[model samples]
Target: MRGSEWVPGVQAAASYEARWLPKDVMAGLVLTTLLVPQGMAYAELAGLPAITGLYTSILCLVAYAIFGPSKVLVLGPDSALGPMIAAVVVPIVLADGDPGKAVALASVLALLVGLFMTVAAVAKLGFVADLLSHPTQLGYINGLAVTIFIGQLPKLFGFSVEGEGLFADVKGFVTGLGDTVPAALAIGGGGLAVILVLQRFLPKVPGILVAVVGAIGAVTLLSLDDVDVVGPLPQGFPPFTIPIVTLGELGMLAAAAVGITLVSVTDTISTASTFAARAGQEVRGNQEMAGIGAANLAAGLFQGFPVSTSGSRTAVAAASGAKTQVTGLVGAVAITLMLVLVPGLLKDMPQPMLAAVVIAASIGLLDIPGMVRLWKQRRIEFALATAAFFGVAVLGVLPGIAVAVALSVLNVFRRAWWPYRTVLAKPAGVDGYHDVAQYPDGAHIGGLVIFRFDAPLIFANARTFREEIRRLAQAGPKWIVIAAEPITDVDTTAADMLEELDEELNAKGISLVFAELKHPVKEKIDRYELTRTIDPAHFYPSLDDAVAAYGQRERDSA
Candidate 1:
């Protein structure tokens, strides 16, 4: 068995060297600085108590270090998953009126998500992550950023707004602006400004840590009473427990679990693939699914919620020269030490400052430049992205995700439903056949037409293919050669259509020929008896050979 197969963690540890220790230690320290604030921030974002973020962060890091395939991936409470968790958990908590029950429900949700991911890994269904295309993903995230930003605005101003959904939150925020506490607004605004400036001018500086510490100090020294703070946290390591929920709520929890699983796996694979590429390493998507599943499972059992790979945290580790999963291990240990030793250190930390942390992270999530590039390069994809953006921003997170997924599936069918087809001709100075639409000056051999269809022959597009072929035949060519290199598959419906087209052509004194047909596709056609109906001799190895044969047949007829 391979080292990774025998023991996943051993692959990183076995190659460890003393020289890499210092960088890993430093990276670990840096990661802890970010993890501490972001964890609590995202936890509250998920409608849980702030301390759960630390629990989620610590457990996920340690779990991922052991089972995760990537050397540098950082697993924790992510801003992207925050609202999603809140959307599912908060409603149940409000209905039950029990905080403990809410935590259990969140844990159950995480456990379900982990199990789904594990099943996907076992089934090698990593390709499901590609259900959302690049543009759709971009738009969904941008929409998420907007959603998160709007949700956090009232918190930043030290006011509570009770509302459901994105628009309702927006409405609450707008009306609640009058109730904002000046101290909270100042701290949140100042912290956000400092983070942005430091990131812009001195990126190597631990800007978030600096901003968080500064806010804490200001709140303490100023004795700020009006500002909302994180208050005191329970000081200890996370205890293990199995989540219990009523059987009646299982169906609702399962739906939420599926949503979380979809987003988490897709986010983890994309982040891992990117960092793995930068490190000149390959990413095992299925393994990543299992690793993230293991991490979420550990978190759920430890009184934490579902977690996913954090691209920002992973980037921090990579930039700080992390060498292995030891970075994550060290970071987890550091957070544990803080929880045990300095649980009250952030007691005066303003809640708005935490809100600022989330806002800063959300800002990074909006890929405006990427959206612009998409708009300029591919207009239709841009439209798809726009649709997803509106779907999330207007419809709410869960509904938006459903809309994005539907759009992705529809985009696939839309392309196949009316795929590109063209006539092929040899340009005077070119050696091979080119699309006549693109090369209008190209020559078409007399009494023959070379046609090309640019997609697999599937049930969806079978009729369209037949119609196009019929239209082309109306030109009354004695021979029609299909440039079949692009037709990768011929399904049962398509094969049947081809057989019918062949017979019709033969009855009209025309021969249907296939050129550049792939072996598998030809085999499929032969299995359907198309070869017998159309004559096996009519197949040619290349478009040029088919053209030569057409020339010989014309000479013989003359």
Candidate 2:
């Protein structure tokens, strides 16, 4: 690949014009407003210090700006990935009783995820993301939203809850409700309300920044010692760090790494495709994998955890009229400046307010409207979505995602295993064969039946195909003409089934013929020598020709 092709930042820079500079600068500023609060909130959500969130944000932005394919995609610590990070790292943290060790483990996980993504990009395995179908993706995200919301409720109420899973978390919150600090609750609730109002009525405003600043002001003026705050942040750029872990922990980390890679790549591609569509740009999935891989690699090396493309932040940038990756670079620079000049800007920001920030973001992840649409449009898909929701809600994040992937793959096989098959006949005033059940008035030739099987003849459905053929033959038709246009391929098992069916039909004094057989399918039959067992002349290029030949044979016999 050429330099321009591999490095999207170089391409963006070459095409840079003065006209876009002002817009990009403004977009960057607007993005920083959300990035700062979100970075910290998600970092804490991930079982890491709030400062690491800022580190992840800065490094990922700069790295993606240099490598990402999309002009507007904003990479950062994501609400969705936070709980997953926590799920994987929190247990290790408890085991070691050291927060630093947990952070190191997460960094190593990020590195592994980055390597997985990079390897996939190099191998052109972008289609691996397709393992999660649309329905499964919706279910997983909705479940994640519920999990995050429940998981953060304890923090939002100004208390910590100990739990093993989503249900336990909810139970812990309910039981500990009496222990919640009134001051903390008031500050957190008020902050959340302000943020929600700003988002609903004044979307263009920087709601998170306003809410955080207001909470800080309230804490200062009232001397609210009861409310938990983030306290002072370490001042300076993120230090270069190497993630260290024991060899025994490598297998566990590898499993977590796979989950992170799946979620990160899927989210990145979906987000990139969405923004690209709006901008009239084509999405390169493989390139995006490489780009996000580079960003994660940077984060892992810079005291950060795994990061993903953030839909909310990306929308902020796009809505603010960002023109290029320069927007991300500007945001990175702005964040670095804040760390240098005002590292303690959010020192008095309440923990509940941060929880509110994260909870609000997670709320956006729920697709209730999407679920409704699915219900109205496709009930089976809605069911699949519901199953995925329960999978995550009950089984926990990692296992739930695994179940979703399994369901997605099974859905594909389920369709192939029992695909639609129908008897076809020439309908009145119709030019071609139609399903006899759907078109009851259609006429079948005196001694011929036209059957249509609407899927490929693969191993899974081969027996079904053979059985259906036998059943249609029992209808007493002297000849069976298969409308094979829908049959794309005939696997070895299906070929053997076909050969056996041919012999059985011949023994019953019925001849089997195939019409509109695709060339590739015909070649498979020929290769299997099934064409010799039945007559090679039984194949026809069109249904009409097959019927015509059958009619001529009947007339010659009469």
Candidate 3:
């Protein structure tokens, strides 16, 4: 068993309750229907043969059910990641156009992603997800949806052209508009319409599946063999094979691998957390990381690209009342049956219809309510959200992710490197110390300035800390008291600088006192023996004790 197997909030999944079997089976059927169309469409998105998406969907769910910590999360190929993978693979595939080479490269990318996730899990670095702030992710995903929706349009029109970026893709579409394959456009566009209509009224009726049957049947009746259909996909299980890559190729794939991995982790964590919350459960971050790692590992070994949790499939399971991870297993099994029994069912699936499948699914990923909540509740978050959204439009999805990461990192230092430093004094009704800004006009003892620092003392901000203290105490208080409760840590460089400050203050006949410091901090000061040079008598257990001691010392001197 893995170290995180006994994760809290996941015990419910392990409980073998026979009574929940009916609910689980019912949920399974619902998710199975939804997963079918999505798996195929996402395969196209990943720039692999449509069948590889089916393989990824089958194995990912099977592995996740056995290893995942969340009960409601359904593992499958995702719409959100489809275009991102396409953006990477399409260019490569178009360059070579070798089906074997394409499959090999995809498998390699999955392997690299799996290894990366496994390393992150072991290192407990799943928190690296924080690099993308919620605001930035919001913007990036929304922008990705736009790019994907547009990219699919050309395919729906049965016109194939190539481009590297969003604008270039639009240009290709315009240039190819004159040569639009009428048969391809008819099948893809008509299929898309059928799906949209069915989704509105017959959501549980496997609309995409229905559309596939109708489109293929119509094309067959019309004898339109000239139209570019998906063609006969292999009707068998995926054969185990390794992706071949040279060192030179690895460096190029790294960017794609890193981008896909980031998006995968982001999707997995968010979806798992959502489902866990629904189950009144807490997800094990490392366990979830390992589960996703295992899925990608399987994808790499077989012929597939990188994958993540499909929000739409998982939501279908939850909404259909899936009681446990059983639904994910069922979905995987259904995908296997499709491969073994009916691979040709999707050979004629219209490309535009496939695009519609993705577009419809992406509609749910909009996150309008969440963004609205932020708008009403916090302006800063709203600004971040908008910035990220626009950034994705201008900067592209991967770069937009980078933007989010940068903002999140800056936020951490923005407060720590320049924290609040307030002066305090005791009067009446109030306690030992209060912010001078909050309590002006209050009587002061006149000989002391007690300033509180709200963050740890470190080299990055020590100079700033000293400057604030100096400026605030220029009123010439005989004693400078540091209400050091908030500050619980310091680096060696900071400790040495404090000693210098102690010496400088002593020469000016001003006493520097420290109070309410955590025990660990006190130990460090003792380690440096800073107490030998400064007045040990100035240290106090509490702010009250320090203030009272100062009053007593003044009375004794008078």
In TM-score terms, which candidate is top?
2
True-structure lDDT of candidate 2: 0.90
Quote the lDDT for 246 in model 1: 89
Give the alpha-carbon lDDT of every model. 0.90, 0.90, 0.77
* Model 2 per-residue lDDT tens digits across residues 1-558: 665787888888888899999999999999999999999999999999999999989998998888888989999999888888888889988988886787798788888888998999888889988999999999999999999998988898899988888899989999999999988888888888889999999998888888999999999999999999999999999999998898877788888888888988888889888988988899999899999899999999988999999988999999999998889988999999999999988899899999999889888899999999999999989999999999999999888888889989999999999999998877888888899788999987887888899999999999998889888887788999889999999998888888888898899999999999999889988889997678899999999899999989999999
Candidates sorted by lDDT, best first: 2, 1, 3
> Once model 3 is optimally superposed onto the true structure by TM-score, how far is the C-alpha of residue 77 displaced, in angstroms?
0.9
Candidate 1 at 145: error in angstroms? 0.5
Per-residue lDDT of candidate 1, residues 317-427 (tens digit):
999999998999999999999989999988888999999999998998999999999989999999999999999888888878888888899999999988999998889
Candidate 3 per-residue lDDT over residues 196-306, each given as its tens digit: 787787876667777777777877789877576777888888888877877777777777778788888887888878777877888788778887888888888888778
RMSD for each of the candidates? 1.4, 1.2, 3.6
TM-score of every candidate relative to the true structure: 0.97, 0.98, 0.87
